[model samples]
Target: MTASLPVATQQDGTYPRPQLMRGAWHPLDGQWDFAFRDDPREAPAGVDFDDTIVVPFPPESPASGIGDTGYHLVAWYRRRVTAEDIADAGAAGTGARVMIRFGAVDWAADVWVNGTHLGSHTGGQTPFSIDATDVLDRDGDNELVVRAVDDPHDVAVLRGKQDWLEEPHAIWYHRTTGIWQPVWLEVVPETHVESLAWSSDVPNGSVTLELTLDARPADELDATVELRIAGELLARTNVRLLDRTTEITLHLARQRNGQQYEHLLWNPETPRLIDATITLGRGASEVDAVSSYLGLRSVQATDRRFLLNGRPLYLRSVLAQNYWPESHLAAPDAAALRREVQLILDLGFNAARVHQKAEDPRFLYWADRLGLMIWGETASAYEFSERAIAALTTEWMALVRRDRSHPSIVAWVPLNESWGVQHIASDARQQAFSRSISDLTRSLDGSRPVISNDGWEHAGSDIWTVHDYEADPEILAHRYGSTAAITELFDGFGPAGRRISVGQQDGGQPVMLTEFGGVSYIDQDVEGAWGYSSASDAQDFARRVGGIVGAVRAATPLAGFCYTQLTDTGQETNGLVRADRSPKIPIEDLRRIIAGD
Candidate 1:
């Protein structure tokens, strides 16, 4: 019920698709009739629409009005689409196609429009759509129904931090079964731009634009793209669209004029985004247009260093669960997503290692504009099997394709702590799975470093990372202060008693203490809340964080370190900030310690 807000009262505001934005789209994020049953074999004939829930928020979330956390395999939702809904999308009156886009639905989703089967989608973390023009009841109201299926006990599914047990336990929390992201409608011209893929070449002062259209182009069809930086025209070109997809490179005028291209580069210090506009037309009149942007940035994993813009950049990062008490996995609002990014940077961390979640695009939008770096990660199935491979592989690929253009994302962690492949250290099949994911990620996006498995047991990785929670500063300093010690440790069982590498250490890759300093501190009583270490007071907490973080910073051979976490989630009280995002200590003091100053 609290999903929609007036267009004002916001900054850069939230839009489902930030990259390809058109002004004529309509939001479908109000209310929907919901049920928890499978009585309907196909569409519209549901057993009952007993409850009304807010769109986008999952039924397990309090914002959804159901707040049901129990295990359920299926959830049904119903709503009515009216003429005003189509009219509000101003572009649909003529030869336009109305597409209903669902930002995400957990596990599996079968949708229907006006009782017509629109087919099903099998992923939980990526966007899918249905061209509903054919099935729309233009003369009257149209009924929209969705049936979502998610098995809580299915270990082969990508559950992320969602607990499969009856109650939340360990680091896992409650499950988000169905309809956890946005649903909206956009009216596109019959020959509109379907997708945009952007990549920047800082060295060449140019950007490569790959565009896909909704249909085959006519003989005289033309597409024009404009690039700008700081309101100054950077590049513009009009290319002929002979096929449905076309690629064009736009070289910036600043680079062509022998000006300093450094000012145009995007980094944490000055996050410069080159704005762009794409237009499709037959001759003079514009058929379709959308505004987009890309950042001129580069990231690399050099031996013993992490490079940003070809400069050695030490990553000060924190693991982000990104869960809210009221909203669970789906962010509470657009402003909340922006606030989380600001909080991470305010604590002196340059990057967020978003653990177990492929973050919302709105979060990436703010990070791209605010100069915060992100290590994008996704959920892993608990077991290694054929089902696990299919589910994880399909979802992960779609996720990568959906997010590869963002400038803030510098790395990808396909698997973490060997969660899905627990026996990867020895099992050949499991090891192959890890390698395949790494290889697949590189094939899709080779611009960012791919960590096959983050903590230990790296089958194929561009960075050698390990998670060690040793509380004593001196012990951690001595353990990782030298390269010889790290190499020796990699030869045997690591801090977690898992093999660090399969055969070789993949020398020349940067080494980092990726997870450490999980010092728990809380002023209030909360049972079962714990961390790797505990502190009694705010001063004690600061001292513990400074000690642990400083130890890793003092390791001369290591590239960087990511502290335990950012905010507390459920029973994990190891956050610099509380569950409600309140700082435990003075913000300045915490920033000083995290910055290793």
Candidate 2:
């Protein structure tokens, strides 16, 4: 036996960070005994294999130690854990509860812990969590089994850009399935804070906090939520809404912290957040408490400019696809995610459009911690309708519920370039469907901005988003200068030309070159064209692409720009790095142009 596989080491390699911790109970994500079975029903009884792979990282990814291979269809992962790992998690003296968390699993996954079958989940994108306090063995090792069936090639299920074709062609995309995220168990107190959500009505001079708590119904607990600035109380409220959902409002008077106030606000330049504490008490006896963070920033359109913290914040952003060559859609490790984010920040960009796929929860978690704004998006194929719409809407709503609290996410993009919409249909039906989905997203999350269709067609959206591919810079500078504030510039192929029919000004609006600079692919092993067309190569990939990026940077009229990609996917070599994560161009070179160095 290879001893019990070791737990995952944090960046510092000292303590274990639970997949997502609320209090004391930490999750077991580092090691799991696994077996690749031809069929799902044939999974063995216990941790009975020498072959061990790290949990969370997909088996196909190089980081998982399984190396790169397309062999898995249905694989099983098993491990044994102890209850003692989560005994004292909440604050210090609070009662404990254990919960299981999955960062993400592709297609579907079936979980069984301690011989009791838990349940299954579909959809390759969002994260899921479950309470496992009941099945935990206090003094003995408990069993954990996961049956992962990923059809990375499945055409029917929402596979995003993952192509079923063995040889990726056109814009079909790379395949990533199975447990692509970390899985662990968390311990919490009997009466404790489950999660903290914040909404800043900056113009209203107030911030509202929605607190979700998990505790026993019989216990009558006094809850006091306090918001402080620089170690002094700014707003304190005692509420009796324990044992159920509760809302607390804190109004600011001159931005003071009970004593002396500072006029400091959160912005892209200096993203400021306050540390808050939730205290649960029975009269004077403090039963439980938890620590949380929140940012006071707002993203919206004002006088034809996107404002951040009441200033016209120009977003020189890029479309970043979180995929490493050896790992595919998975990052080599959490540090890799941080490194990429830092690269963007170092480039002097304020935001990233997390294009196509829903990134790892930890990625978003760090985005919040590091203060990078995001245009969170979902993956859609070249199809559309009520069924697809329903699925997309359901998944997006769940995504918002899980990630809305994060300060990094500023916008939600449901459809991109009509990837999943049937564009062949009449414009009326297309517009109606597009508008419907956009409206649905708005109704669900009214706090952040929503982009209906990211490319040529503007069915309806809060931002006049576009994607342009024109080589000439003058077209955007002078051709279309009098339009809505949300104009998006694509390869000029979709609706811009048609929308400006019969001699009308194309009002440049807040001209954002949403898509451009797909400089083509030139990896020795893989040869392919850029997604939309064929106009680039490996020899000239960097210079040609860098020329375009530099051109956009020099063009001051453009509000923002999003290069076609951050990393290359299979067959698509336009990324700054090769599909396997090897940098195509030197980092210092890209940094020079990105940072205007």
Candidate 3:
């Protein structure tokens, strides 16, 4: 039997984009026609969708209302869009652009509007959009069809923790097929903001904003970018749009008195955000405007310690996979996402290592607003192939571009436990590939640290991270307590029985115990639930947990630690809370243990 669903209300049906908000939007997130095809060659247009599945929830999820745990190579979804959905457009239907946006669809997605193929997207973790303005029928209804193909065994596809077998096992869970995130319709002007990338230098008191605009070659455009803090205009500038992308750097370094502006830095304790706006204009006529927000923060590592906003900080984080017993990978709603973050913070964790999956943007938005540090990670494919490398590289670039602006994200984890490149230490090509991806991530955004391969056999990682499930507190402390012990443990053999250091050594880089202490606490009713080690009862679990956490906290050389998980996932009974987000141990006790009280 599955766990009970969380009693949280759905999001207020607002646009999913919190960083960049548009005035008008239509969320397509209720119910949709769903069909599963055995043959991968099946086309969505030819099939008559007979079954109904909830939007934004995978077919395997109980919340989808079609709980088919079996592998489905191809899945199709059909929905109708009426002109009323885009009626809020600028000119009712004349020269108005209606963009169809999908927060994410697993594996690969082929979209069609009004029987016309708009485009296709391959990445499952990043958002994509298509301008359906030309194909939209303003007077009547339009058919929207999506064909999603997901093959968990195919190493070319980044499947995260999705189990390749027919049933869930170990750390891998059920497959998330079809649209796993929100779908919506947005109306935009001809020359609206496509995307924005923000980079801040808190020490220098400056921020560089890059804007990518959706414009035609014929439309000449200029933009006025303004930075505001509580209604006061901090900086304003204008630039000619000679190209589709333009960047401007706002230096808030000096005041009229030749003194530096006292900048507010963002951290888990204080996540202050500054408002921003970009207005596109043609000569003197304003064509389009978009609103956004940013936070000023910087992350750096020196002397084997992490420095957030120029102050040394220890990361007390949890391994958050963002899975639900009812919805699988999808949250019940936006409020559920916020609740999860609040839960993490309430448990005395200032940060979370969002393991494997590239989480929904709404979670990151809340993390930014509510002050939670996130280690942005990419889903990994198990096998290393030309196709796998291409898929991972493409999706990781898009993921970085999509999430780099958020101040809550302090690091980018490209791979986990050498899942895709397992033989990196022995294989020359795999080692090169690992370094290439690391270099590429740094090139994309140099502001944050990059963990090339998180768990072990590190190739080119900014932070030395290891995963150990040793239940004995003495053994755990002996493994990573001192610099000499760390060097011996990492330099001799790795945690996963592989060679510890590959390309980089355990230099002065900060060392983090990314995974450990998956102590199991199974309810008597829940069969097949297990963790790394079993606990007899709540008292036993608390004693073991306190022992492990106290040992890690006393470790002088270790920079931080992330417990095995925040909540229980399918078959994994190692969560601090159960699958339904109910606490196993007392909240106060768990918080004290995690906080080293």
Candidate 4:
């Protein structure tokens, strides 16, 4: 019989310094007892604990220690945390409530601690946090069990690139099962800061700060928020909390009092973020303090161009899918995610259109820390049942709730070109789901803009996002004021000879070459044959991407663009870089075109 891995038994279980968390995160991502069953109802009793597997990484992943025997099944994770852990947390001033946070779990999960059921959640892409203070065994070891179920057959849920067909082909892969995200516990003071929200009104040179606090009736429960410009204080405000939520507005008076006028406003070239510190309390006797920040920028489209902070700013972006063979959805470490960000920065791109799904929180944390603009999207690209729809809607709301604190995410795309949404002509269920997703995202997250659909089939979004795959860049430039190429290679060729057509196309909107390059998998020398076309060489891919950059730049009407992809995904090899994150082509090739050479 295989021995089960020992769970960390310290005062605090284990805190892996996740490369992506803005602050500190206790990583509950280590080994835990796992079991897989054909029917979730036929769960094994606790006495049969030997049938367990690992937590976070799906049973199919190599990291999960279960070989590719292929168990497309449902299971539960069981572990025990002592009351001593909770007591230690309570002793610390930061401790008030212990919440179990899941980075992500596949399909659906229902959690219970110490025999008390917390709640159930669905949607595989977003994070979910639940308060486990009351449910814990305060005096002894507490049993924690997470039951998760994923039906690969269910198409209505948002399952990005995951395939139920076992073998991943073309652009899909084996579905991730069970908890795939960092699971840990955090202790918050009973009267701690619950959430933070920010809005950037660059035109008026002002920002509104919204703080949600725990219900605590202290004599002076006013929250003080201080704003800083490049480590220097610009403005500060103190507002009284009324029912756990309060909004305070701050105006940045004239470009940091005498610095260069251009230096004051945050521009694309020199993007700036105003840091903030929120303190809850009366004078020195503060109850809690949370560090947060916001950017002085806005994303909108005008007759002149896609405006950032009311100024015409071009979006030289890249389509970034947060996936790695070794790590799958989760990054190996925060540094790994940071390295991905550095790769984009090195590629001369300014923004990342987080393709199909929302990324790890740490990825967003790094984006905020690194000044990278992000388009935060929901995993809404699958077709599922009515039960799945209801479950997904709850998951989407929680996703926005957990992520609304980050400022790096400037826009939100809830649905993508209708991946799982299906045929728009006759599916009323799909249309309703699309509309419902848009409404939920908009209502939950009002701080940033939301896109109902990323590529095609616009439901209701701030921008009319259009996806095009024409041979002519100029013709695309005339149409969809801002067009994005969801398919990286147009007409199946590289960047060198791609055309720049003129006249009206795509409804005459600004053009954004969103997706162009794709999978240059690491084993390209061995597996680089393009079945669709004969001209599938590294040079061909390079030439195609290089040409599009030139064509778009040459055609001044093009607002901004994104390459086909940041890395080769599965079998769709056209990336400037390989799937293993090794550079397939030189960065100079892309630099030259982005520089308009």
Candidate 5:
């Protein structure tokens, strides 16, 4: 069945980078020349493009207008760039450096600007850029070509839930090939802000900001960083840029105009954000400036509870795959993204465990703005190999660096359900690798909690998370009621049976039922529709959901619970909402069950 378009179309000219905004920019969206080939050889100069695909949408998606689900190992895209695009870029006496940024492209991507070879990027889920200033022809139209290659079956590649078979089965869906996010061009000065790292100390009421510049000090340049709240300047500092990076701390607890100020903390209820402006100047002349914002919040976990901003917080979350029937991984528009978050909130969910895929930055931006918590997870590969390990680690690090600044992301989940490291319980090296990754994440950012391997055998995890699909609520409550019940439940277990609870039991750590209640409901008689358990009708689905969630909530020691899913995708007909986002059960009924009202 073909899916209908969303109510609102995505704005064509909306800047892709919302965290850091600059004035001079152009979107490279819309239609682009596309061609499919079997080999990865360079495109022949005279070859004619046979098809057109929409930018930011994968070829396999209906939104791309090219519903080619067949695997194409190599795909090429070409677009024309006119000189008029960069006319107003170099206006401030500073030489303009034009950079073409790709929000995300699947697997591997190589680029050429005016036939000049630019760089290539490997990961499919993170953003990357190519400096096009040197190669673009300012007088005439320039040719831009991109070649992307993806092999979904390759165990080394992190394909997430994209099935390798011709048709999707089980939890896996159709593959997303080529570009899946918006492409745009940005104009910046010779030396610009490359990235910003943030950390907040809630108890001390202060925040530290680390600014990384594109280049080292070319001359004696002074950098000024200012923090403001609702247009009232809180603090400002100036530093001499002698290196590539500088760090500044802004103490929120201070006296301003002989009056004391109280620290405003960010929570799911009130996600307060403070604005920031960074300026680089040579002597008295301003060379570069950028605007950004940050939320002052802290996430910590004690033995028995999860703490947000130093207060005990309970998570009512849903598993969000972030997929659509028409758009596959990409949301049809920004409005659809907002609608999804609103639906989650309306259904009484405060957080989302983003399943498998690393969601779009725009979605995260909304989460930060709308006061929703997120459990950031990496897309895990199925095979265990050196190549897979390296690829997963590299991409996981990139994901961390790309998203660590967002205050909404309270936890980092590196692995889920032992997807890639199946032998982690028996293999020492695999266990060590898991510990290394957990340590690495903590070292990179010590502010948030890290779950090395979620769901079952966890070696190094701050929060002990488990996934149980037992449909009976009585059994679930009996099993998780007390510390003795958990101990006796897994006593004298072998390696295979101990997959659910490996290592020594720790009651001090926060316990969470991360995955449960995948009760299915089929409105129509469709083949291959499945879930953990099937319900006959809407009332039956609601009853089963209430039983499962109510049971988990009655287990008082449990910190939180994440329902199976937010919406249906592919054959997984267990979501609260249908594949097209229509509610399978009444919203109020589901909310009452989820909120334990």
Candidate 6:
């Protein structure tokens, strides 16, 4: 297994955005005064303080010190930011702005500083920032207040696996109400780089960088771009920033031959990253600078196989729920996030279908460093309505804008199990919605394939997939054994008694057993513990797992496969590892089977 690169710093000072690194930032992830109120007050000016809860952990989790599972339609949080903290963030100087960024706040959130209302954001999952430069009291304590509202029964909202009931049941788990991720402060110049996007052309050995600036430049500014590998400078160029957005392409020096490309191209075997440094300058003095990295690779779904760098690479993947017994959606710590990536590689999988939730960026960073492919997925809204469409489209697109720079994300799964468009099989409007989303995803980023709706009843997809829990190896092999059977299965019913192809499918696209082999195993029976197929003991567990995975590997028409899950989340016990992350059997035994040896 490839060792994961150590996180650069601890949680208190961890750089949340690893690809784009800045030196001036301060984390706001400690104790905060919290209270539950769905009252008439818009802000928390006169509200009484009741309890203290940890930042970045929702009130539902035990880690937050308040394990409230009931419906709290509205929640309030307040914290005092000292002048020292602002100065430490480097935002107190002239022409510098202090931006308070929230990793995420559920449903909707309204922010206020010193009793002045800044604004409100609607998306629950995506990150947001507010400039507190004007309202912040630089010499004294600045009271920052936030009001969060996450309606427990709002099915129109994209609530991934968060169960709405009082207790978790079936596939759903506990709710993560408010502030489940980090909050931090950063200082930036008036004209600074906002974000960057990279696109690599492997055949030409050139990478194009699209840079977005914070504001329009009053005068023409010059910028210098540098690319390095292993601390060795590979390419350096100068670009003129006449507009707020600019593009520059750099042709790498040593990627002229197949052998050189093999050594430097990003793959699970050789995950080479070219470090980048961008400096914005006004004549001679440096205005702003930041550090980032890029991975030169390409992915496509073509000719019945998933291609990585124009080569057929079979995807040995597991469905990563990315949940924990303690932290629900958030990682217990930075180290635990790294361990999750390492454990996936140790189990002999090259890719992961990060199911449901749009995962933390830190997890994506580890995957990029350790060379694991990811099928990026987003949470889904259960009901089909105008509100659901607007909510899902807005947040899902924002998620794409935020995460498109990560090289480890090879594909995008906008919806799963036909969650939002449940009636796509028969309804035309839902079917149209599914197709439009797939088209939109392709339009935004054409570098990778997009699965419109996973599982059966696909409206449109680049690679056709199916979810079958057929435990018998012989039956499973025969089901996907022949090309004729494989071709016919798409036009007919699938294992779930739903049509494999509904609206549209590319004739030459890849066909993979993306999801299967969910055989539940445990020491003994516990309430609500179940699987499609059960194993009685260790011997049976190994046999069932080995047989199911081997069956998929032996099937000639199958290009790839993803096992049921990576970990046992909530009530689901079909994971390869236990909920506490203990190996049900020896790790090596499972690795051998998963690797098809």
lDDT per residue for candidate 3 within 1-597, as digits (tens), equals: 001211011123245766676556788888889899866666665797899999999999989999999978889999888878777533443355788899999978989888888999998898999889888887799989999988867877898989989898888899899899999988777667888888987766788998887754356778887777666677888887887778888876343332434346678887877777777788987777777788888898767898898788999999998999889999987789989999999999999998889999889888888899999998899899989999999999999999999999999999888899988889989988888999999999999888888888888888888899999999988888888998786667866697757868656888889999999997656657888998999999999988998999889898888898899888888999998899998898899999866
- After superposing candidate 6 on the true structure, give the runs of residues whose Cα lies further than 4 Å from its correct spot: 1-13
| Candidate 1, superposed: residue stretches over 4 Å from native | 1-11, 38-43, 257-259
* Location of the lowest summed lDDT over 10 successive residues in candidate 2: 1-10
| Runs in model 4 lying further than 4 Å from the true structure | 1-25, 42-47, 51-55, 67-71, 82-95, 135-140, 216-220, 253-268, 282-284, 384-392, 426-450, 459-464, 468-509, 517-536, 594-597
**Two-way TM-score contest, 5 vs 6, winner:** 6
lDDT (10s digit) by residue, model 5, range 340-420: 878898899999998999988778777877888999997888888998899898999998988898889999998888888
Q: Clashes in model 1: which pairs?
A: none
Tens digit of per-residue lDDT, candidate 4, span 1-597: 001111111111123312111233344666788767667665335425555555566777666766342646676788877666555443345446787777778877888886777887777876667888876766788878888888777766777777757677666656678877678766666687766777766556677876677664555677777777656788888887766677789887764454444555444456565667776776667666656656666666545256665567677788877777666666666578778877887778778887766677767656765667787776654665676567567767876776765656667776666666655425667667767787888787665556565654555555544444444445543443232342232222223232222111233344454554342424445342332222355686566556555565554555666666777666666555766887766777666655543
**Model 3 error, position 183 (Å):** 0.6
Better of 3 and 4 by TM-score: 3
The candidate 4 region of ten consecutive residues with least summed lDDT is: 1-10
Q: Where in model 5 is the C-alpha error above 4 Å? A: 1-13, 44-47, 88-93, 254-263, 489-498, 501-507
**C-alpha root-mean-square deviation, candidate 6:** 3.2
TM-score of model number 6: 0.96
Residue 357, model 5, lDDT: 91
The digit string of per-residue lDDT tens for model 2 on 473-507 reads 45444433433322333223332353411111243
Most accurate candidate by lDDT: 1
lDDT for residue 131 in candidate 5, whole number 0-100? 95
Q: In terms of lDDT, which candidate is stronger, 3 or 6?
A: 6
CA lDDT of each prediction against the hidden true structure: 0.86, 0.65, 0.84, 0.62, 0.81, 0.85
Candidate order (lDDT): 1, 6, 3, 5, 2, 4
- Candidate 1 global CA lDDT score: 0.86
